[model samples]
Target chain A: MNTHLVEPEIVMAYRDGQLAAGEAAGVRAHLETCAECQEIAASLDDVSAQMRAWTVEEPSPQLAWRVAGRAGKPKGKFWWWHWPTAALVTAVLVVAVLPWKRPPAPTVQTGWLPVGSVRTSESNLPLPPAEPRRHDSVAEIGPQAQARTGQLGGVIGGIVSATPMAAPPTSVQRRTQAQFAMEARRGAAIPVPTAPMIARDATLNLTVKDFASVRDVVERIVRVHRGFAQNLALTYQAGRNNLTATLRIPDPELDRTLADLRYLGKVDQEAQNGEDLQAQHVDLAARIANSRVAEARLKELLANRTGKLSDVVEAENELSRVREDIERMQAQISSMENRVEFATVNLRISDTPPVPAPSSVWRGLSEAGRNGLTILGEGLMGVATWLLEYLPTLIVIVLVFFFPVRWLWRKLQARPAFRLPN
Target chain B: MDLTGSDESLMLEVKQGSEPAFIALFERYARPIHGYFRRRMGDPQRAEDLAQETFLALLKGARRYERRALFRTYLYAIAMNLLSAERRRAAKDRGSTTDEPATSADPDAVLWVRRAVEQLDDQQREVLLLREYEQLSYEEIAGLLNVPVNTVRSRLFRARMAMKELLVTR
Candidate 1:
């Protein structure tokens, strides 16, 4: 082993000047008396000195200027760094930062998770009783609803995660790589039922007058229809509150659940989708069957047939690969069946504060004053926003070109290169 | 920041767009970076281009740099990634090409050293060149390579021994 082929790290550290002063003093003392350590130290020093023979030429002076050009312009073209991108970014900042009191994101890991009911088809259980809604976040929801909602299970990691409204339609059943790896190790092959499978999902967007009651109602409705809130999040904004939840109900109760949830508010939009997974399930089943036969033939070959050591190794490799395929196809089939078993309901509820009536003359005057201050703030914000966005780019540009431009200006004033001898 | 400040502080100035700071850093590492690429490839033009790209990449990513890291290691990390990419491209274009770069008129000594350095294992060679050519400390090499300090020490030791054997045989 090379462990003993050379001196230890102490010798190398001593040669490389990596040791502290006291350690260096000790190594130097040892080096004077020890012959083998002396030889190793001599070898390390000679190799370093000999490597100096391979010298590289100094780079051309043009290299720095080319790098400077590319420092600002990514494409190495000067025109690419013009004012348009900065201007566009400034416009966006003015639009976004002018109204800057953003509702903070939900502080994660503060609250409840689902009970073990998610792992089994307990969809026939009755809805838990309804309770009064708290005018806060999902973190403060009741323990009973907590039992039925909001837990970070493996199923939660693999399912339609809770997301905000106006973002987009949230994707359902997106398994993370970690979850799949865990599933692979667990050897939990989902039993593929010989039945037609139709996976159903829906999105319901509603405008509710009473914002606080909506989460409670949605939870109750999911439970009443034998479904569970796979993931839930409630966001509160000034003069408005948003409740967006991804609910998982049994396929039989999807229509009834959608109906009860709509009664909580005014329906603005509704979308329903049903994807038939029978063809995919059949395809996976056939692939698994074929791989299983191949796996068995290899296993039989390894156990009964005599062959060379290399041939046995090859057969073992092929057998493991075939079993891996069988597991992967079986996992895919299981995932599809799980999707078909529960219908996904994406529920979003929003509220707008009631407009106050002008009961007296002060109301009108107060609103006018507020509006005037808002206009003044926006006007000042436009300039501040532009500076905030473009200041960094401006500094980089000036720094990169400052010396060369200054030299050119000084040269023009002193020599006037283009002028004839006068 | 002045020319005498630590490289990390100079880099902080570079983060604030100080050209003098950038110049100080460039002058400090230009030859080492150029040699880093030049020692590993036969083409001087490609090496020059890659060395320039390292500096440009540094400027492009300067804003995101944290002062906790030594500036030299960060710079070498970029150079290493670029060299890796160049080697991959070269391998696909020309199989089994040697890295015998353009050298001084004294070819026998210089070519012998290059061949000896090249004969070491890839990782061990990296550690040796970083020590001999770039003169990076062991801790810096460990940080740059994302390896343990002990690993860097062992690799550097083995590499130095291997180079000694190869050079003597020649």
Candidate 2:
């Protein structure tokens, strides 16, 4: 074996000046006798010299002119550096810095999930009542009515004997009733003999890949569970989709619904809250009794003709007020009961898909076209929206302030480029 | 010892709108940069064009330059990129043809050296040039090219060995 070929790398080390002093001396001794290694060193030197020969032409004189011209332009001259350029500078600074300053977007985890109810329908057993009011219904009524009315409920039944107003006319009554019902529905002060409920509240944020499919499944689930979607919003984009929904599921099915929702994707967030309204139910029951007693007293005053006209008028007014109060209270009780019967579930579904880079020219063109249109539309819409929102202010400024500013600017521009310092 | 500071001070003076400082930097680096391109390109006109571009680039990029690394390294890095880009464009224009046979007057020693140098691979060629012509230390070359010192050593060694073999064969 050729000794030099045995370790060509050693020759390299020698060339690199990495050889120890002793090693270098030995290499040098070998080199004095060996023509091959010497030739290698010479070749290395020639190669280095050849590599240094790669140079380029001077850029055009026009290039210097272009850069200098751009730098010297009135518009470009320390544009953001002048006090007068504050607004422009702010814009430039934001444009320059914002991209780098922006924090990376939070990564979204998403998957395909069923649109339907996650839980099976369960009985909406009525919730226990909330705390009772301090005053019992019968206790608030006058003693005289208490003796004659056979309970306030019966006494109220007999008063206002003048055709009993026939529950008012449907059109007039419907609106008032609707209003009353709305109040009752919202207030939960009146009791409708609704089924006993197990009230529950659940919040779930999950990821889903197919928003449309999930939405469909959710709707089906709501139907199967005998629940309703109170409010829902779905947003779709090319690479992402999301759905936020408020569902009123039967209280008994809430737990099951939550469990099923978990199957959709990794539950990023979840929460639940519940309260029993049983005591409130009992308190409302007592208030209805007392209102009935007040009605009885007023009816007696109207029917007996034992008091003066003024007294009778006062009594009738009092009776009307009592009955109205009773109706309002009942509406509130009903609303409360309904809420207790239904469990509210706020579900947030996120569909995050990996953004596949456009590979082909056609895809790129299409994407570019879409992006162009979007940017164009967004720009137009942004301008339109800004104009719409601030048009009045802008108009006022143009009339009251901007016209003068413009006139001043024109006057300033008319001045010599080299102006005397103020 | 303070090569970076010297280069930076020169550049700083230039950025302060000093024409002379810029001219000085140009004069100092001109031949080196010219030789750099001249060795690679067969056509003198093209090499001259690239050299001018290097100086102009240095001028325009003066204010933007950061002194995090050696100024020479930075300048050469820019020059290298420009050269590579030009070569790519030329290659593309010529329908991706590489290795057109050199037809130069010095069919003697210079031609022989060019052939032997060209025989080495790209990394080998770069390592040879950086060490022998630029006189960069192994560490400096490694840092400039963003490679390990050992890699630079090995490449340089391979280049020398290859050139040796090629020259001897001739």
Candidate 3:
């Protein structure tokens, strides 16, 4: 027997039959001769025996009854009825969540419609007065006798003419004839203006290094061009100044003025539109002529004192209405002329440059720090808002599902095969 | 009537909703599982609760059962989880307190064994208890503990040596 024996690990492995076959044979051959290693092996076996001696009592019989009672309740079974209910709940959840997910439609601003494009209806025009008729007796009285008698004899003869005067042209028929005559004269006399009556307009989006200086330049340009600036707005912000102004320049000088203004800043965007007002101008002129003729006829009717007193009063009313139409037409013509004379330029100027890269490391670090803090604040606010938005939903979900989930959890923990340790 | 089938077969039947197969499994494992819990916990009632919980888990999880390993290994894994949960619950209850109450039910050989086992570190003690009390093989212990077989062997060897020394000193 060799006094030098194997290590304790090999002895333990040997006793447990965990060693390789060759090693086990070596240890077995060694243990056959070594009492010290045998004693160690005996001691290990003694520990195992000592542990095994701590016998524990079996669980109570009622435990099986309780467990079987739970098992017997048809757990883990797929009830055919659950499918429709689950589908319905899923549908409800999807519908509830959809509105929150859908994005809002953006708003679009449509450009203004060109001037006088919409025609004013003839029905909207003022009524013309009834035309005055020459009395039969006045017709018999020679023009020389009426002139010698003066305006009073003419009026007396007009009233003394007993034969009802031939039916006067209706107000509408008279207006149509007047309009037709005007159109005929327009065709013969003045050739319609061949040059387009354009109302010129432009929009400029400019980025400048100095907004105030640029604005001063704009003002100087307007004055040089004999123009005016209207609807001027200036806004000052943290990083820049914004100026929005509408400038009116003579139509002949608009191109030159726009070219000069472009030198003040970088033009990010520029848009020009020219609306033709030829038809509008022609219509306004015709309407004005017709209204004037109506006014003259009403005045004659009133002076002659034709028909009854009611007729006289009615003629005066028609005169007033015709006067209003004339005034309105005059105003429209004036505005249209002004638009054709001057071009409008809408200028939006900003001095804000794009944020540049940080020049130094410290600047970058400070920027990063500021950005981080901002993000943190925003994130916290976002979280708070999210919690507030969904708090009621969360509460309902917890209230509805908490007990069943807890019960199922407890049941899962009770099952020996499937229960996971906490 | 066919109670003599293998644990896997019985589990398959249980998965198919056979009450008899479930009863057969329950009758076979109830006592061992109870004993497993009773040996580790001081309270018999808690042990019973744990045992019942183990069976309930089995019944509940029957539909998901797959025969990847021995049924006993799976069973003991569940028991281990329950025991771990119980320890965590007890630890939470002892919040901010450093002392732990003695948890042995018996005052004789069981107490001595528990004291000796407690003298080892957590890993060695677990290896020793699973090996000595539950009589799980080294390979089974390795699988259950998620360690390599050699590590299990070394840990069990060290645990035995330490346990032997403690018993001698006591």
Candidate 4:
């Protein structure tokens, strides 16, 4: 009657038939005598009996069709998510291969370079000796340009002006000759300021059929005439398209650049003008000289200062202000000289359909549909390209992993939870 | 088709495309697997679908089925996978939160017992259910839950004592 109470764990184990026979006998003896152990045993059995109350019937047959065909693709609910895997792989292939199959985008050249920057120092170049002499302010630099080409065709600016600029350099070789002649005469006495120091510029408006081809031609002409685009803008719209080019051409090359530009399309309008910047150039030069003299005087004071600290500071500030003025005026003169050196041409080429049929809503909708179809066609092509390029590779990759994965899965599937080393 | 063969042997026959053999295994385990899902899921229709999914998984993976272990284990493994997936989906549908399985609508005593079982700690509750209803041995549960056998034993002990205490109070 004095057996100790059985532990709940042993009681449960005995109930579960897990205890050894000897342990079960001992627990049974304790249960027979001990009211507490007997209750624990009864409770253990009662728990199982209670759990048995929550019974469920067999499921209906509706779920039979879901697995009717090869697992019905699983709705990708499982870990594999087969459909998502396929979609992801397809997307990856599309991203990887489409660019190679798609046609290249249009290439439009842009950016600018310095004007007549061919010479580091123009005065250092060899001159075309005594090239020409003329009276009026004409294309003297232009004649020098044409003389090098040996064409002497006609007056570039106006007849009986300065040197008569002959004709367009017939060939690349002739243009090279002109460049060399300019390189030479640029040697000395190239009074870009007094070479009439005229800032010559032109504006040409043209309508062209092929904007791309004409743009290429315009680029070529600028290269030939030793010019560069200062700024160029293009508006490629559906109903209208235009290219505005602000070019900087050496004054001597202005005529040739204009001639080449003229041939791009039918000229809608053309105008050329020369602003005499001689007065401004002279004024800038005089002011700069005066500022430089003042700067030198201040420099002397700064170098050998014999004054109070505040006076020295004031003088130093004054000298700095004077030097700033000098540099500003010098920059203005340099800019003026450069303007005379490179004339600015504002040219616009447009492909706007002239006075034609008005657009209708129906036409717009038709255009939209056509655009959609075009996009869809390209998308399909991208998909097809991806399939052609990667499907085989993907299949090979899947094949590579399928057997081993299947083996491992079967290994896992077989055990279900029975044999573990630990 | 030997309908009365061992589970593994029947599964082998099922793998070999024996229709009668599959029907045999289905009849044998259908209620158990359905109960497995039914105990954890609130919806009977959902439980049915998961049960169907487990069998379908078996049918689909039959070719890959090997005889390295018992057929019931493999079948239960598939049922466990479907249950886990169903739980995840339910959790997501519930704003990404999860609660214990619901108490059944059985009669008064049965409902009390079910509530006490549901109120058990998750691992202990699961261990008790597996041991009690599914009749999985402690070692089988340890392997299924990927824990040591001692853990399964202690959890079962704690679960039974707690279930007894709960049943007494109610």
**The best candidate in terms of lDDT:** 1
For model 4 chain A, the run of ten residues with the poorest summed lDDT: A113-122
Worst 10 residues of 3 chain A by lDDT: A115-124
Model 4 clash count equals 1
Taking the tens digit of each residue's C-alpha lDDT, what string does model 3 give over A19-47? 78998999999999888998988998898
For candidate 1, the docking band is incorrect
- Name the better of 3 and 4 by DockQ: 3
Task: After superposing candidate 1 on the true structure, give the runs of residues whose Cα lies further than 4 Å from its correct spot.
Answer: A1-9, A73-422, B95-106
Shift in Å, residue A228, candidate 4: 65
Candidates in order, TM-scores: namely 0.43, 0.36, 0.41, 0.39
lDDT of 4 at B165: 84
User: How do the residues A1-422 of candidate 2 rate in per-residue lDDT, one tens digit apiece?
Assistant: 66674255566677768677998888877878888878766666664555345333443334333333323212222343223345444444544454432223223324433332221122112212222223222122244323323332322221111112112111111123466556543543344334433356889998765455676556544543446788889887666788899997656556655664665566789999876666666677678778777777778778998979999888888988987888877776656655665678999888767778889999999999999999999899989966675566445534554455556545544433221111
lDDT of 1 by residue, A171-201 (tens): 2333444665665456444335466678999
Tell me, by TM-score, which candidate is best: 1
- For model 1, give the TM-score of chain B: 0.92
Q: Cα lDDT of all candidates, in order? A: 0.69, 0.60, 0.67, 0.65
CAPRI quality band, candidate 2 = incorrect
RMSD of each: 34.9, 19.7, 22.5, 21.8
Per-residue lDDT over A52-136 for candidate 4, one digit per residue giving the tens place of the 0 to 100 score: 8877655654444444333423222342524335545755665566554332322321221111111111111211222233231
lDDT of 1 by residue, B125-154 (tens): 889889888989999999999999999988
iRMS, candidate 3, in Å: value is 5.6
